[model samples]
Target: MERSHVPVLPAEIVEFLKPDTTNAGPVVDCTLGEGGHSALLLEHAPDSRLIGVDADATMIERARYFLGPRASQVEFVCAWYDDFWLSYTGARPHRVLFDLGISTFHLAGSGRGFTFREDEPLDMRLSDSVMSAAELLSGISQEDLADIIYVFGEERYSRRIAAAIVRARSSGSLRTTGDLVETVASAVPAAYRRGRISPATRTFQALRIAVNAELERLRMALPRALAALSPDRGRMAVITFHSLEDRLVKWAFRAAAGDEAAVGRSAVTAKHSTASKFAPKLIDTVAMPEGERITVLTRRPVVPSHEEVAGNPASRSAKLRVVEKTRIEESW
Candidate 1:
């Protein structure tokens, strides 16, 4: 099958970003998977430049090809967002977009086991620098593995699944995605296995998150992204697929926006909330600012429209949150 990616929330992104028409600054795409979103953004605002960043080298090449000569206006960087943010010395971005969902290329062709339907190797690393999911599972302790699954995947049967994996590893049977999927299926209850969603979904998601250190990377990149935004004129949008990611974006933006009402309503302290039970450790990973620097454009995350969901089932879980940098006061 041909690999293709449908940029989620296209109309909303263009509508909200309203990319600077005068080429005032670049619109940075932190997760330039297939470059669908960036291409659309450029097309909408022809004068806008793009700074597209992706960790996968294949994605970089593909995005370059996809962008054609328009790629000249885009700076395609092959590095993880956090690293790219650290070394970046570019014009302040008027718009920044981060679509955290995995790309269709990885799901369909890269064969890194993003999809459980395929019996590929259990290597979910987004880049070659990190340890593959297979290596991670085979090396970690059962307790730690269970914690990772429970925290990142929010899988209720994480303990059972971890125990099964340990046993399978001892027998040298847990090497491929098929093995992991079977192990998870055997660990969960019959009802859970028969549920609408695959029993392996959570486990696969957890493995992918751990292998990519996704949460950690996001935590590191958010602050830098905020700093890069052009005050008063900058807009940033983030699309998260999972609860852990959504919560991080929600609170981080809330704190930055200084939305006292939202912060007051948080179950735990905005600075440090371990209330999730699932990803308790992640609360500390993201440092929420105590003061205002931006405006939360969306009170709640924007979900995919019914029409969009019907067209692309994979986009059903997408939640988009936007924020705009607050105007700076000149120090006379």
Candidate 2:
């Protein structure tokens, strides 16, 4: 399978990123799943340097091959975006792109069990993490497992599915993607199995999220990336395929902006409080100045165009949200 994973929302990303056109600094492709977005940015901004990061070693290798000569312009790292953000203390980057969720290649053919259609091992770790889907199923309590499916995957049949998984595991290890699919199928009503969507889809999604710690990692990474962004000189773009990931990105951006407001008020108070010796104490601060923060570019997230969705079914669910860091004085 030629890794049918086409980059989602390429034109929208390029338009918002505006790479190097304004003499912006370096750009970071935080997800860099096959370097599709990176290659486009490099083509648009010949002078800009690229930092590409992915947790999967296989993705980095594939990116190198696919990007070829353009790959030379990028500094590739095989690490999660969270760790990359912490380790990267260099000059603030001009832009960052985060495409969350599994790439088409992984879902279609990686044999990592991203899809229930494949009979691969139940291993959904994006990185070489300690936990695999099988291990998670084997270890977690049924209640916790059901909660994960309910909260993360939003599956209606979470209780039944989780119970089925526990029952199956008790007999023999539920060790493969086939095992999980069958377990979920058995739990749902026969009518559900023949519904418009697969009965097992949400269960697989929940397990993948659990195995990869995707949401938690994104929550941790977004702040650090914002902190490293140049005031008014940087932008971050995130493409989320589902509601769970989109919710995290939306709230994180709002929270960061809110913190920025609080910090400014504190700054003014500190100056006046000096005489009283109160010191306008900073309780806890992860606040970046308003100028050095994120400004949501899309009041409403940008979705794939009708034509694009028609052409690539995988892109149908994609929603792109962009935030640009503005100078503290600039009203976002």
Candidate 3:
């Protein structure tokens, strides 16, 4: 079957990010899945350059093919976003975009065990990451595995599933995607399996996250990304597809914005209360002010429009939050 690729919230993302004004700067597409959003951004902002990053090498290649001549203007990096930050030593970008979680193509086509429907190898490494789902399940203790599934996937029957997996592995190694699926199916009651969603979904999601270290990587990468932003000019946008990711982004943005606000207040109070010759500068001249270093542009995350959702059902779960690095002086 031919796989279809669709960009989520194209019009809204373009509108939220007025890339047209950034004539000479670069925009980082942090999760450049299929390059659909990158293509639109490039089309809208003809003069702006692009730095596209993706953990999946196949998606990067697809972007290159679809983007064609515009591909020359884009710099594609096949690495996890966290590692990308570690290796990058360049000018701060004007805009950054992070579309978190699996893309439609990855869920539907990639034989990485992202979805339970396909019985492929039980591998779920987005990058050439050290761990695979099968390895993780086999190595971890049953209790620890249950904890991972419960916390990451919010699976209610985590203990049952974990016990089943352990039993299955003891008899014969759980090596394939089908083996894992069947294990999960057997753990849940037959009645529940006939419900709206498959019982295996959460277990699969949990395994995928653990295999790729998704949450851990996001936690480490966010601060580094904030630090890399150019004062006043840099803007970062993140789209999260799951609650765990959404919560992380929400808390990160709130913390940054709160810090910025506090710093600004401190500077104002210092300027009015003290008049000594040795009085420190109201704004930190050495660093971008916290206020300038980051601002939460979206009070609430932007969701796909009704039309967009209708056209692409996979995007129904997406939530976009944006942060801008302003011109004031304080640490991020």
Best by TM-score: 1
Clashing pairs in 2: 291-326, 291-327, 291-328
lDDT of 3 at 199: 90
Alpha carbon lDDT of each predicted model: 0.82, 0.79, 0.77
Instruction: List residue ranges in candidate 2 displaced over 4 A.
Output: 1-3, 21-24, 259-286, 290-293, 330-332
lDDT value, residue 154 of candidate 2: 73
RMSD list, candidates in order: 3.5, 8.5, 9.6
Candidate 3 residue pairs in clash (backbone atoms < 3 Å): 288-330, 289-329, 289-330, 290-330, 292-326
1 against 2, candidate with superior lDDT? 1
Tens digits of per-residue lDDT, candidate 2, 117-196, equal: 88999889888755988778878898888877875677888899999999999999587889888989999999999999
How does model 3 score by TM-score? 0.86
Candidate 3 lDDT trough over 10 residues, lowest sum = 277-286
Q: Report residue 3 deviation for candidate 3 (angstroms).
A: 6.2
User: Which should have the higher lDDT, number 1 or number 3?
Assistant: 1
In candidate 2 the C-alpha lDDT for residue 130 amounts to: 51
Better of 1 and 3 by TM-score: 1
